[model samples]
Target: MFLFKKNKDLLEQYTKYLELCAETLDIFRKAIAYSFENGLNEHFEVLAGKVHAMESDADDIRRQIERTMYEQSLLPESREDLLDIIERIDMVPNCADHLATLMTLQRTPINPALKSEIMELLDLAIESFKYTKEAAVDCFLKMEKVKGLKILIDNNESLGDKLEHKMIRTVFAENTGTGEKIIQKDMINQVGEICNLCEHVMDRIVICSIKRQL
Candidate 1:
């Protein structure tokens, strides 16, 4: 009975952390979209602030999870797998912060190709996170729903990969001059990395769920 109660509490805490992660991803997608649409340099500062706040929230959640895990003495069959899954979820916000920092440093106009691809990547990443959050919630409520959620998550990850590869090709092909090309390349890399991290988190979630099932 005590173990059941502890598991319930831990699951609640994990769900809260997942919600926080989803909120952070939503903020990131909005900020990225706004930046591209307006091309206003000032919005970069605001976006950076949002990313920083999300990062702080993620850190707090990580600490909370650690404390709960220790206190509850809830030992899973694969502790490392569980921790990796949690850490990847935490990393989404950190990667968002990195992307915002790149935006903050930009003073000139972004390449048209880069802008379009970045927005697509952000959209796919956001969708991936949405399904991941749903999967997490469903895990606690109805484990059967998780099977469909996993498929959606996988589809989003594939979209991200396609966007990233296309963006890389476009970045190299565009003649944005030497110095400008370097800057754009770095920015594109960071944005692509954010999508990659999102996929990583989704994959970890799927793995964690499978382990739980086994």
Candidate 2:
């Protein structure tokens, strides 16, 4: 009974970690929108700070859960699988924090013409995250739901890739300096990477679910 309680507590902490990831992504979305609307002003800086803070909080929870799992005495394979999933999920917020910190520090100039495409990409990335996050929760709560969610996550990643390519081509075609074109393209890639990372996480989620079933 005590071991069961420990395992259950670990699961609860894991759920909280996932919730933090959701909050972090929402803050990231707001920061991106604010930056687009206001051009990375003081208000945007505040939003970025919130994103970083929430991500740090999530990291703390992840570490706590990891330690709890180690102490719970679950099957080695099962424990390793859960730990791997948590590590992969951690990448989503880490990417968000990295991108937010980069924008805050570098202050890259976003070209007016690319604003629409960039916004669209950002929206798609967030959508992908929502589905992926849901699927992740379901992996532990309801294993059967994962396959369906994987499809939605994959679609978003595909759309993001096409849009990213179009934006990159458009960036270079503009009559700007080569250096600026490269920088803007990198920014677009960073945003699109969110979707890619989401898809990557879902792949592991699906595999883990399957392994559990077997």
Which candidate comes out best when scored by TM-score?
2
In candidate 1, the residue pairs with backbone N, CA or C atoms under 3 Å apart (3 or more residues apart, or in different chains) clash, namely: none
TM-score of each: 0.82, 0.92
Colliding pairs, model 2: none
Candidate 2 TM-score versus the reference: 0.92
State the weakest 10-residue window (summed lDDT) of model 2. 1-10
- 109: Cα error in model 2, Å: 3.4
Kindly list the per-residue Cα lDDT of model 2 for residues 125-205, writing each as its tens digit: 788878887877677665768998899999999999999999999999989899999888888888888899999999998
Local distance difference test scores for all models: 0.69, 0.84
